[model samples]
Target: MKSGHSGWVLAIARTLDAYGLSHEDIFRQVGMDPEMLRDANSRYWQEMISRLWCTAVKETGDPNFGLKVARQIRPSSFHVVGHAMSCSATLGAAIHRFARYAKLISSSAMIELTESDDQLKLVLAFDTGDMPVLPETMDTVIAGLVCFNNWIAGENVPPLEVRFRRPHPADAEEYLRLLQCPVLFEQDEDSILYSQTDMHRPVLSADEQLASTLDNMAVTQLGQLSERFSRRVRDCLLQQLEQESEVSRKATAELMHMTERTLLRRLKDEGTTFQEVLDNLREELAYQYLQRPDCTVQSVSFMLGFSDASTFSRAFKRWTGRRPSLAQHNGTAEHA
Candidate 1:
């Protein structure tokens, strides 16, 4: 997670420098040592950064004070990563690329992309560890999305819709001004929605070489989600199911050194059930394996711990409402 302070510190510093504000006066008002900004490495501490941002806005009486600061920095400050995204085939592809390669940019937020029948959604979920204070946190989310979309497309996005997990604050009017969209409050998820028509509007030409290079890297990063769990545990379960190629809940529970009752309870506490985790892991591993033309459906079924190809087929249908082959076909269509 990015330290909340880092975003604020950078914004504040840039804002002060741009407006030619009395650096001493602003720093004192924000209760920050001006010298801290001189050292590029000092911005990692999030709490201090958050405090600096809040103090600056309160003292300066500027709701968009931070954005005003950001306006002054050149797009070139973002380097090659920025250049690559700016040249992406379309805003959708750029966002997808950004979400996949986000660690190269910042660890503060987890960017997620989801597609459904009605709309495509982009979510920038902030880490609880580096929680930004109210308005600034909210502002940053709105501003960053707007700026990113604009920069990539070389035009304004003016998002079609915005939703926030948090309620509207006093400065809600200002948020509307920045987002230039219909802002919904207290929604089920904090996300921005775009029409599918926008997804395929190509901005960067298809470069086989570049796409392949990025795909390999993105998949490698995506695979790290598995590392959070012990490989030994993951491997053991995967191996056990390969022979019989399927196991009941009781069997899996016993193998993991817990009773079925306890396992169910624990998984619930973690905001996931056994079936949900199993399905998620299965889907991910399936995607990984299905990438190879030589990978057979029967072989993939065995690897996923399904008793037989039939059972795997049923499960795959349930997961994606299509057979494995068709799902892969659909995946290709979506990416294309």
Candidate 2:
């Protein structure tokens, strides 16, 4: 149910413009803010985007609007993910890189790369069951992958088969024509199967060092919009916790390449202090761990940097106004 970036709205606007329709008007029709286009960091509820896609289809009277939308994709539209893809050593490298950082493009969806004896399948799907991308949205995603890879590899890297969850439209001809390969519909999943030969094809623009560098930079930039300063500190703490080390503000600040004062100031601007964010994350994570039947209170305590199981039990009661055992009981009941 995570929100996607503002870039999608702007891309939709450009697509609508081709049909003499106003993208802003369409956005407003869906009760979304057209002003969101101004900030790449701005996001819209996933449901609004579902509505926007439906509205855009009706307004444009184009069954293949999704394909048209795919055509409008520009390299800059994908941000650092695009650059990293372009610099990958081979088409396989590019596709893998794209999958690795696909969340930077849209958190609602994910790209899975699977290998077969003679083929490689790239499956694009909604990672979360609750917020599935609309059928038309999948259309853009499938075609968009083909279009992106073609451009990045400096050739038309058509797939052996393209599968869609939606049924065939009256005008799938355009889709077939644009894809330069077979376009399938009413399939079990949304995917593109590339031949192994195509998978190994060299990316015309490959640069190993530069691609690695851009990926590093992109990781730092992606997902920053939602949590801002708090996310950075949370990430630092998560690393320390994973390493079974104590979390401290000085260590977190140093890991972020910032002074403690500067980190504290930034967190304050986000309406939280570092300790607050850390505890909030810890509490949320604690609840998640406790809700799992296999996790023990003592283990959860250790993960949260508590001195003992009793200390964690008291903190959990304070955070949720109930004992950890009570929460676990409720969770088990809900599942039952």
Candidate 3:
């Protein structure tokens, strides 16, 4: 399962407390344990994080709930990567480091750094699995980047422009005021733009020797946390299916940045095949979606990327020897 650092969970909890909300209540409401934050190595499931965002937004009734959370983030919120970024020589170097080890922060998303003669862009993309990427999720991520940049620079280093894939919200004044930049919505991608000058500015806390040590540590940690080839393929498939994108073996191979033959050979080495992984993933997700009270067989089928209810039902029977309706009923009982 895709997971994020527990530091983020703690950051959210702190934000909840600041808002006079019970973090315990919020955690329980989303099926997460408050005690999980105590384990520094623990990672929260991506699905639970998504639920927590939705729940927090609903409870706070604040359009800028995400921005509030972003402002609350401490250096600890990013784990070792946070320290690594802080120790980098320049803002550009720090961001390059971040993009390299972004998976250490959250496996469900990626940050890409691109440069033009005058500007650098940090583009944010999500591999959301079956969950939809909420507006608050996007807001917290982009805003947090800005907040951290300013903190490390020891000055307000606002972006040149910010763009979000999400449509315009009901109110954007807070976004304008906090970001202090031209914010555009309904854009092709979610990204932050910084002038090349700001990107090259020296980090106030730069320590070259310590940065080298931290980079070595981060590389070791990243090697330890790397997902297996088959698992990576499954994750790619999940993202494509979740987005209703084209879901062919060729498409999946392209997403993984490998040729079809190479992907096949690697999966074979791992004792799995592309079709097997896809079927297993669909079966797993079928059961998971059935357990949700709000989901029906029709919706679940669509989510599983099946052509129709009958097709999904046949697949379900092949896996569990029962129709989805029966499984849904049993799942509801177990959930209660």
Candidate 4:
């Protein structure tokens, strides 16, 4: 398969084949388009891909799609990146390197590592820029991270906390099962946090030569420009929006040291819109607020730049297909 979201569709076919099943059977059971599996590099919408995965799992009774895929990947396959990550000195460093070279594995989302006095966190912030087709991007990231870690440590190590940038929806139990850990929804960030001590635990190997070779291979396979430039733009937009409380296209362009027109054109060329990117950031922030019982809907509304509670409520409803009050009560809105 030619690796991409389209490739993932093919992976479903490949999975069925490995399981002594046919695509016709899988598609008929799952209600997905068998034609989608034919494309090599085609990208589906984020929500669509997630729905297909969920359907496949439910129809096939396979809860291990994510894990099975990760494990089947060979050393020379995308799994090589996992092998490289396993060789890192510490989990934190491994996550850092993963974020730095994620494009090699997939042009999906970038994993971010955040540390505070209380915990070490990994955030799999999605990139609308790449038009990622998985609505459960965070779920896959966390699952893949755990799978990768277990691969490296040769043991299961659950996260202390899991947070999603989006609201809770059906099939959430799969997340719980995959993670085997506490899960929080409507979080400000799509992240998993662990005790700081976990960061220091040595991984499978500390071999400098292995690490260096992996780094070189990662760069050779996945060019540095995509990851670096995307992160640079994303970070700038995030900082400007959070710190300055402004994220105008003009302002973002200036921050990127480019003209507004250039920025707009480039973003367009990359298949994303400024408003969509802004929404992704706002959604992440909303998840964070919901995770805090003390955070009020009114406060979150204003923080998201809604003119009033009603406006925020409507937007929230549109975003997650439920009223804000529901999310307030449940700490996570129902997905659309």
Candidate 5:
């Protein structure tokens, strides 16, 4: 499942409280664990997070709910990536760094930077698979990017124009008031266009050594995150293999609160696939089961989700270049 840092959840909770809304009630209503807020390392599932945003918008009935929430965001909300951005030499460098480490915030969404002769555009896009992204969610993210940019710059670094994919709101006064720029709706993409001159301006908190250290940490964290995600998929598959005769990608994706396409994509990003993970896991289990004196090949076949002993033997041979019976007799067989 794609997840975001819990800091986002806390920021939203704080915003809801400021609006006299009960964040705990909203979290429960959306099937989210409110206790996740207490853990700094906890991640909120993408689907549950979208529900939280929708619920917050519906309950508050504020057209600028997302903007208000963005205003409440702090550097700590982004974890180390935010601090790294803060120490960037220039606005352009900061934005580039943000785009590079965007996955640290949320894997379901991406931020891209494009440049023209005199303007820079920060484009935002979400890949939630089959889930529909709410306008409020987009608003919070885009607005938050701009707010963070301004914060790091230590001055109001207004964008040249702000564009949204959503239709024009009934009242756009709040957007203009908060964005302080020409806001356009129904645009091809949700983006913030800034002048190149402004982007080249040096950041007030620029620290080369600190930025380098933070960047290295972010890279290491990203690697660890990928490993953790792969482990999560393996764990999910292990559980399903115990319960079902045949486990489909769709079923596993549903269990993970993501779409099959997303699951496949995430696995691909980790240099594997569902089938590969399943096969490898079964191979590992086959060896363990064979090592047990009480377990037979037929029983092990069934336990590993194979339909028959012959099929299991063929798969076992392919994995270890030896028959299951031989592997069992030999105590262990080296994998091919």
Candidate 6:
């Protein structure tokens, strides 16, 4: 699947150049044609991204290469999505929005937000079957989220903890120092955890009016992204779910420019249905919204498109086998 923007390849190039290494050579060595990344808006395959990371680590001889690469991400790297995030009302709100629109970043991977009693966990899960999550790539994502939030807040907002699925690196202390939090390795997932209360901390760059405008632009652009048919349908549901509007099969099909029957047939070939896709999207988003300290059951229910809180409550219970209110009390990561 299309993994990430060519801007990522550009970011890798810039990082390597900063370290006095020939990034173009590394790009070519990894079997990536330099011309493929010439257009910043074009996307490269996920396997190519993985291969580039593997090559970069070996040539640079730096276990901390991904951290260095993350530091180089400016707003331009993320385009309008970065603008929306920077102008969001709060750190948590920005991150939440990012999760909702993360298909803007990678088609094969998704960001999930969850919280326990005291900590908020941002989990990075990839859907690239049979493809291992590269440690270097994991570092870049975790570090990028940390760095971006701190940039948005205009101050260091250290995470409560950082967890990685990869084994400990030789330069683990760098992760600790940069994150200013305990960093654990070989965890069940790659996640960044912050105190639940830290989520409401106001962003210094926030301009809600501008943020609202940018968010609308993002939603329109999000639906236009080229991706798997099911994923495109899933993106449609995300917007409807966020607006508290019903995700009707007819509406979804219309958005995708296909007849309802054709859309359903395509989804079936993709091993899903419109209703199944909508329910899964809501369930995933429900955990993300419920985990935030500021979000209430009523607010979350509305955001997820249920007619009323009670209906959403029943659906949430069906999805999690427990109440959404109680999800925050459990330390275990809720699987979507």
* TM values, all candidates: 0.51, 0.66, 0.71, 0.50, 0.71, 0.65
Greater lDDT among 2 and 4 belongs to 2
What is the per-residue lDDT of model 3 for residues 1-336, given as tens digits with 9 covering 90 to 100? 677889977888998999999998787655566887997766766877887888899999988888898998777788888899999999988888888888888887778888999999899987977678988888988898889989999989999999999889899999988899999999999999999999889999999899999999888878756756777888999999899987888999899898999999999986779987898688767757887888889888888888888888887777655577876735442211
What's the residue-level lDDT of 216 in candidate 4?
Answer: 88
Model 4, span 29-140: residue lDDT tens: 3223467556433343443344456555665566455544544333333344656777788776777777777655556556777779868777776554523434343455
After superposition, the stretches of candidate 2 with alpha carbons farther than 4 Å from their true spots are: 127-132, 222-336
lDDT of 6 by residue, 1-336 (tens): 356777666778898898899877776554455675677566655666776787788888888989998898766567677788999999888888878777777777678888678877788987766557778888887888798889988889999889999988876888877789989998898888898788889988889999999889878867766646877887888777666666799888887788999999999986668887787667656755765777777877888877888888888777546666665424344333
lDDT of 1 at 159: 70
Clashing pairs in 1: 1-108, 2-108, 5-46, 5-49, 5-50, 15-69, 88-204, 89-203, 89-204
The per-residue C-alpha lDDT of model 3 at residue 204 equals: 93
Model 5 lDDT tens row, 160-223 = 9999998899999888877889999999999989999998889999997999999999999888
Q: Per-residue lDDT tens digits of candidate 2, residues 1-336? A: 345667755677899998998887676545466876886656665556666787798888777788888887766556677788889999988888778877777767677788977998888887544435567788887787789899987878888999888988887878888788988889898898889888889988889999999988877866465457676677788889889887888888888899999999998987778877777667656755765777777788888898888888887666545566655625442211
Worst 10 residues of 6 by lDDT: 327-336
lDDT of each candidate versus the true structure: 0.58, 0.76, 0.84, 0.62, 0.83, 0.77
Candidate order by lDDT, highest to lowest?
3, 5, 6, 2, 4, 1
- For residues 205-320, write the lDDT of model 1, one tens digit per residue: 44546755656654564454334233323454555655654555677777878788887776675455677656645764675566566667777787887777788888766654
Colliding residue pairs in candidate 3:
none
TM-score quality measure for candidate 2: 0.66
In candidate 2, how many Å is residue 52 off?
A: 1.5
